[model samples]
Target chain A: MTITTGYIISALLLFGIGMNGLMTCSHQLRKILAVNLMASGVFLILIVTGFGTDGSAIDHVPHAMVLTGIVISVSTTALALTLACRIQQRLNRSADETAEGNDDD
Target chain B: MNGGLTGMKKRKQSMKGKFKRKDWQFATLTSLLIATLVTFLCWAILKEPPGEDLTAEALAPLFVQSGVTSPVTAILLNFRGYDTLLEVMVLFLAGLGIWSQATVDPTNPLVFSSPATHPTKPNFHGPGPELILATLVRILIPLMVLVAGYLTWAGGFQAGGAFQGGALLGGAGILLILAEPQRISTIPPALIRFGIVLGPAIFLLVGVSCFGYGGNFLQYPQPGAGSWLLLIEFGAAISIGITLTTLFVGGRPDPKRLKGTDQP
Candidate 1:
């Protein structure tokens, strides 16, 4: 297979795997990781799209778009991670309170 | 990690055991269908012919002429600058969200009004970094700083840009924070707020200024586009660095709340 086709196929497989993981995973952290994996797959596709065919140079627009995508994805990931941490903390705190109440009984 | 993996495996096994035969059959069928669809899509891509290089031929040259030698930088900071501006705002908004979630009560001045403590102390019982990590950070910070500066400057002509430089700077900041998270609290809130907003604020101000000059919004004054682009990149790098570091810290750092309570 041509290099372009190879790259595209790998990226597509990555996207499929990531989506499957996202849909099937029960854990929040794993879901986040799946999302990140999906993002990386998209990034790869974007970069590959910039690749020139027939000896032409790579496209700069897609490169710029990928850069912007990377930054935005990072922000989203941070926010998601923060939410996950808060949820875990709240869950643990409630569990502790329940344990204390049971001890009193 | 091995224990966690095994625990997860056990849970998955128990969950599978609870599912009926029909449920398992359906799930297997769905997965097979999805896999077939993905394979077909890949095959379609492989069968497609190579397309024209319109981006390289038409857009790249125009972007480069905007007083920046690097086409990607020119596109990011000039040709499609609105996207970059909004991207910074995305990061800024993330910081704002984290700040809002911080336990630091804004109305309570007592918690946030403390003075700076010594920087060397480890405040949290959270797993401390190894001696090797500390030594690596000490040796690498200056080099990272230098590389970041170089990347920001080289963005005018080469493959580097504000984002790359900012990421490097942010990495350095995160390393330091990991060594002593409480030291993050030593930074004044006002300064942190300014750092988070600076990039978007400057970008908007510049865009608005163009309106005053009767040019289209975000159009750099024709004569000094290079200098204008550089200034914007510098502001953006600083803000991006700050925003990334704040994200890593996971909360708005309050110097007033630090004081002696930060010590372990």
Candidate 2:
């Protein structure tokens, strides 16, 4: 297979791995990581598509789009991580309260 | 009581085993489904015919008019300015959302804690930041700032831009926070708020002002396009840097800490 096709296949594999992780992992942090992996795969595919076969000039449009995508992904990941931390903190607080009640009983 | 505790431990072990088995099966099924979907996607990609290169051809002719020598920068800040404008807003919104959802966890050792307040808290990470790390941060932060500025300027003609520069600045800010979290609080909250809002505000202003220049929204007049792009990039890089650092800080600043009334 050509090098370009090889990259495309690898990118697909990455996406598949991420999807499997997202579906199977119970941890919120792991799920967020999986989503990031999926995004990376998508970005790779866009870059490869922009890189035309043999004698063609590199496409700048996809490069710009990828840059934009990267920024958006960072924002989303930060927000998700914050939400996850909040959830964990709340869970821990409730667990502590339950343990205190058990002790009192 | 000992016997009861042992019985409870055995029950928990058995329950964990059952859950593990279930999880293994679920993982296997999900992987299989994902594999099949990926294989189909790969087949489709391979079979698809290559399309004509319309964008590159169109972009080539208008590259000069877009103001920046770098095609990517020109496209980002000029041609597709709306995407960037909305993107900055999204980043700002995320910062806002995070601020609203939670406050900085005081228990986190990464945050500044006075010896008097957290005397009982074990130093799990280390004996705290070493002199070597402090010196390294001191040396590197200024350099990072300089490089970030260079990258922003270089974006007009080369492979560097506001995003890269902003990221670098963000890294420097994170390093500063890690080294001395207390130092971050010394900066006025209002200034931090301004820094976070600067990018989107400037971008919106520029787009609106384009109407006076006899062009559509975000359309720079042909003669002064480069300067407008530079201005936008400068504002965007600073805002992006502050926004990223704020995101890492993980919550809104405490008013008491900002006012310097709270000891530690």
The runs of at least 3 residues in candidate 1 whose Cα sits more than 4 Å from the true structure, single-residue gaps closed, are: A99-105, B1-30, B104-136, B254-264
Off by over 4 Å in 2: A99-105, B1-22, B105-129, B257-264
lDDT of 1 at B53: 70
Could you tell me the fnat of model 2? Answer: 0.84
Return the top candidate by TM-score: 2
DockQ of each: 0.61, 0.74
Clashing pairs in 1: B112-B256, B113-B256, B114-B256
Candidate 1: give its CA RMSD in angstroms: 7.5
lDDT of 2 by residue, B1-264 (tens): 999999999999999999999989988988888989999999999998468898888779899898889999998999999998998898899888877765553333244222212222333345556899899998999999999999999999999988999999999988887776666656767898899999889999999999999999999989979999899898989999999998998887655444555544
Taking all chains together, each candidate's TM-score versus the true structure is 0.82, 0.88
Clashing residue pairs in candidate 2, if any? Answer: none
